[model samples]
Target: MPRVQDVPSIPPAGRADDGGALPPVLDVQDLKTFFPTDAGTVRAVNGVSFAVREGETLAIVGESGSGKSVTGLTIMRLLGRAGAQIAGGEIWLTRGDGNRVDLARLADADMERLRGSEIAMIFQDPMSSLNPVFPVGEQIAEPLRLHKGLSRRAARAAAVELLALVGLSDPARQVDAFPHQLSGGMRQRIMIAIALACEPRLLIADEPTTALDVTVQAQIIALLRALQARRRMAMIFVTHDLHLVGDVADRVAVMYASQVVEEGPVADVLATPAHPYTRALLACVPRQQRGEKRRRMTPIPGTMPSALAVPSGCRFHPRCAHAAARCIEAVPALEAIAPDRRARCVRWREIGP
Candidate 1:
């Protein structure tokens, strides 16, 4: 965790990119979030920027505690108000009919209304997110009841439908069961059902398959893809798995220490990554091929710099194999490396893979 003072803020007025017209769902620019800690303020999301277009899956990939989940929480307006401060930035959210809203500036009351109904989220941990005391049906129905003002009976009926839609068998009977009665996968499915209660235009799925088995993970991924195609909903899929991102994401945004290191179309970014950090990450993912004697996976040399003690220049320079003296002196800007691609490395061009 880098200290607040050490992490440089991205210019509030971000680059005027000709990435053509903005996406008709979510646009975030220079977003920064900090938490007040006893040691110092921890810069969780540092000048991160990206957009999720309508009906497209934009994946944010990073290691644990890389501010991936924090970015999603910030977008959902779930950040704590008292000690957790949104230091700076603009979040432009577009509605169904090409209308745009500055989400960062919206009041709490306004944000509350937009959440669950317009923009929903499936958090990382289903067990922690679901209410232990409430029956699963009521818990799922709560969002629909509040957002749609459905009658209790109607909401309960709809909840069963949602559960069934997520592939739960005997949804009507299972609805009356409590969270403890369900398996981990079932609880995650319930969370998805609750998130989709109102058919949100955008879904932020933050590591939605964290605790599931490999088979269940594949099922959940397929489920999300199916739902996205059927509903035409924009999504921000946050996960550490590069392999998983390639499977479903249209575009990929790589994050390290609360900052975006590389971003581009998923295929191009994965096939030919420009950032050293991105390359290092990809090298670690296992590939199955005959005669492929397992080589030591190239881990990004050192551990991630603590958010509280973030390096002065490029935060990743210390771990970056291509680090130069200049990297220690000045923070690198996320400059365009090619069309529809950007990287935060001064030597990206010079240091070819």
Candidate 2:
């Protein structure tokens, strides 16, 4: 495994290296997303930062409304014009062939080209993501035909192949079926097939296995891991399940109130989370082993603060049991607590997972 120090630091925007080559695969520095509403400007993602390396799985875990989906949408440049806005920061993208592009600044036409071809997303609701009028095959084939310039016949055949690759049975028969015809798990498989159709270097899966049976969830997860391994693709797995993150994530970024509160190797963060929020989340996961008869899960106290009225300093401080006076007065920088591990808590060193 490569050490954290070995991963090169991505230079700031407009400050590319003299020999200026390509940008990082996905370099996100201090990204922020705001939504202007009747009441106030909702900061959905505030100064959140991370990177997704080629052929790695970075999992973002947070409670609902913690800006997980917003971050993913921002990276894909899919945020709509009506309410959302990228207030600051840069999203740099590097293609497989070494071409560097700034995703945040790319024109609409260029961004369209990159969406399905260079990058793809697997949305949470397979039922809603698929179009009712279009046959499953056509939905999968659309990207292939659009990006790869494949003939109609070739695209159709490729779609069948993708279906089989994602573990669907009877690819030919399933191809002609509509989204409503397939089971939840099967529809998710189809979504994976479409996302993988273009051989995108980056795949953002937003809670891909949710709303499925346990057996089906396991299968979908296994399929994702296999596809990621076979394609050597960089994947962003967004889910609230720490157990799932333990199984798949190479690295983990814990988000709270539109901010990356902590990030580091999956094992390190899971075993000994430095941030109070991280520790509280870990404690909430149910364990069935031979420990003392467990009380009910120790869910974090208090509900998530509303997006429009996020607390100052550390967003997690209000719910954090270990919060101190400093936590209320000043915000914390994402300083290194360990090699490649960082936390946005002034007293990270004192807390234990």
- Give all TM-scores, in the order shown: 0.90, 0.92
How far in Å is the alpha carbon of 329 misplaced in model 2? Answer: 1.6
lDDT of each: 0.86, 0.86
How displaced is residue 105 in candidate 1, in Å?
A: 1.4
Clashes of each: 7, 0
Q: Model 1: runs farther than 4 Å from truth?
A: 1-22
lDDT tens string, model 1, 133-163? 9999999999888988899999999999999
Query: Lowest-scoring 10 consecutive residues by lDDT in candidate 2?
Result: 1-10
TM-score of 2: 0.92
List residue ranges in candidate 2 displaced over 4 A. 1-24, 288-292
lDDT of 2 by residue, 1-353 (tens): 11112222344546433245433467788899899999999999999878887778999999899999899999998899657988998877777666566677777777788888889999889999999999999999999988889999999999999999998889999999999988999999999999999999899999988788889999998889998999888999999888789888999999998999999999888888899888888788765668768757888899999998888888888998888999989888999887689999998777654
Superposition TM-score, candidate 1 onto the true structure: 0.90
